[model samples]
Target: MRRVPESAEAARTLVRTALAAWGQRDLIEDAALVITALVSNAVHHARLESIRVIVTRPSEKCVRLGVVDRSRNIPYLRTDSDGDNTRGRGLLLVDALTDRWGTDRYRWGKQVWGELTCD
Candidate 1:
């Protein structure tokens, strides 16, 4: 789904709808958090031009969620941060919550994606 939500709530709703189809109610919060953070990062750093959230069921037990932004910059996990730093923890949270995650560059931009397994 491609959306240009002016706020985080709209992004959360998109994630909720995707997860609901898989009957993975328990993963909603984590998924929403991941989506929100990615979208926020795109908005803040990538200029928030356009966002694409793709939800794919690669198999019966695995669902992949991808957030594609207009920027081609790939996200990295920043560990060396000041204790007082308020930003730069989104990907870390995604790493902790999802089964697997990574990024790939596309023709238009780059996609930061995570996979959740309903095992």
Candidate 2:
């Protein structure tokens, strides 16, 4: 399923709903945090006109969540160049928390996706 929301709260809510529906309540907090960071990055850095959230279940024990933004710019993993900088740590958190995550580029935009194992 794909949902487009204009605000961060809305995006979080969408993620929460998906988590609930998947019977993965335990993952909601981290999932929501990741969604918020990705969506916020889409809105802020990509200047995306809209964002699409997609939740898919490929197996009984795994759920894949993707945040698609209308930007061709790809996201990268970066080490903090300055210790005092307050940003650029979101993807780092995602990497640490999720079982698997990656980015896919499409013709119109790109999808940043993460997989959560419910088992």
- Top TM-score hit: 2
Please give the CA lDDT of all the candidate structures.
0.77, 0.77
Score candidate 1 by TM-score against the native.
0.85
Off by over 4 Å in 2: 1-6
lDDT of 2 by residue, 13-111 (tens): 878898898788998988888777777667666654567777778898887777887788888777867688857877887787778899999998889
Residue-by-residue lDDT tens digits, candidate 1, 40-101: 66766664456776777899888777777778788898878769887888888888888989
- What is the TM-score (0 to 1) of candidate 2? 0.86
Off by more than 4 A, model 1: 1-6
**Whole-model lDDT, candidate 1?**
0.77
